[model samples]
Target: MKNRAILIILSLLLFIIVTPSQAQTYQTGSYQTGVGIRMGNTGGISVKHFMDGRHAVEGILSARWGGIGVTGLMEWHKEAFRTEGLNFYYGFGGHLYLGRYQRYRRNYYYESRGAIGIDGILGLEYHLPRAPITGSLDWKPAINLIGRTGYHEGGLALTVRYTF
Candidate 1:
């Protein structure tokens, strides 16, 4: 009986010492905003600003199809109910395209197009338990509101950022 009581007391003391240390190691930040360059054939500089705790606004300036384009986006983020260290986000936005394209016949086609439409994003982000690095993957779908009439585009991207 005395041995069992000693063992229980030791276990309780160990739990009391370790619990606070584990809780203290979970570090999170707020209102993260950043800008960075994307690497790809259709890549650009992107900026994202977080609003409140679960919403964000984003903008991108990219070159595509020999034209320069700009996009505006809004996103909402939520913590995954059953997962730790995971967040899911979604949102919408618009874009404008400018510049020119060359036809197969060697003719030059100049375009000054503007598109205003909705965007949907589904993504998962993981924040390192006490670290400043965040990693994410997301899919974005956008619909064109101007030239091409009923054109739409969808893409997936990976993101990494350092939180402050």
Candidate 2:
């Protein structure tokens, strides 16, 4: 737990330090960085950064039914219809689930282990041109490839983030 905290902190520091230097390389929709919470079937922390006008990356740390999971994604974005500030994005990523879960049924008990999975996302985002807030609605589907292998379908999220 302690080591995980340190690694998360270090990663955020590196993102903050490295982002600005690469900022001038490309144009962005609204703000270059955004951080906030997401609500859906699961609750999580979300951070997104636009490396350029059409390319972005996102990271999520989620608390779910079985355990905690972390996901990373690389995305491509394009303008949505003729709407200003509205964009649609598609991405592919992966997740790592950690922690153990146990179910008790009278005298019988079952335990489940953590798993690693692949993730795909499709979403619509609106970055308000005059405000520091960005709102998005997205669907993420995941398929477990390790541990207990299966497909997970409930991965919709609504997010409101402060951009800078």
Candidate 3:
């Protein structure tokens, strides 16, 4: 409980720290590729690329609930409230999970018991004009289809990436 509060606070602080004020001028052209770390409901590494200013693809490799998994998303972006480097995005994706579970005091093989799910993401991202960094806050909820069938509405995360 306490740790969760701290995590929320820290995420908010990162958002505040990364937000830019008006009167700041960004470079004429921003980079297309980025790599970063994501922390939240599940912690992991993320890679993203902008095919253009408004369309992008992101990939995530992470561990969730003590299990390793990977996800890929295709997102659409739009400017945020007149902020030059700020944008809001939404996307759809899927995930593959390789996990192990104990049942009735027995250990099961992970390969034989894996989960697959569809994911949806919505987030706000800020690209630092003068630095090679970007910050984002997002909610990524998923519905499990294989192994476990249900809706998981708990996918909120904060990410920071080095854009190049």
Which residue runs does candidate 3 get wrong by more than 4 Å? 1-29, 103-112
Query: TM-score winner among the candidates?
Result: 2
For model 3, residues 1-164, the per-residue Cα lDDT tens digits are 54564455457546644665332333213879999999998669999998866678999998865678899998877677777888877777898888764344246533336779887777899988899999999988776789765677656899999989
Model 1 per-residue lDDT tens digits across residues 1-164: 54564355456445533542322333224438756554443357777777656667878788877678887888766665545667766665777777554445347554444444555555687776777666667766555556644434356677666666
lDDT of 2 by residue, 1-164 (tens): 54564355456445543543322333456688999998896459999998878789999999876679899988877667657788877777899888776778689886667889887777899988889999999888777888657676646789889999
Q: Which residue pairs clash within candidate 2?
A: none
List where candidate 1 sits over 4 angstroms from the true fold.
Answer: 1-31, 39-42, 104-116
Better of 2 and 3 by lDDT: 2
- In model 2, the runs with Cα more than 4 Å from the true position are 1-28, 104-109
Ranking by lDDT: 2, 3, 1
Better of 1 and 2 by lDDT: 2
Residue 105 lDDT (model 1): 38
Query: Model 1 — which ten-residue stretch has the worst lDDT?
Result: 19-28
lDDT of 1 at 69: 82
Candidate 3: worst 10 consecutive residues by lDDT? 20-29
- Candidate-wise lDDT, in order: 0.61, 0.77, 0.77
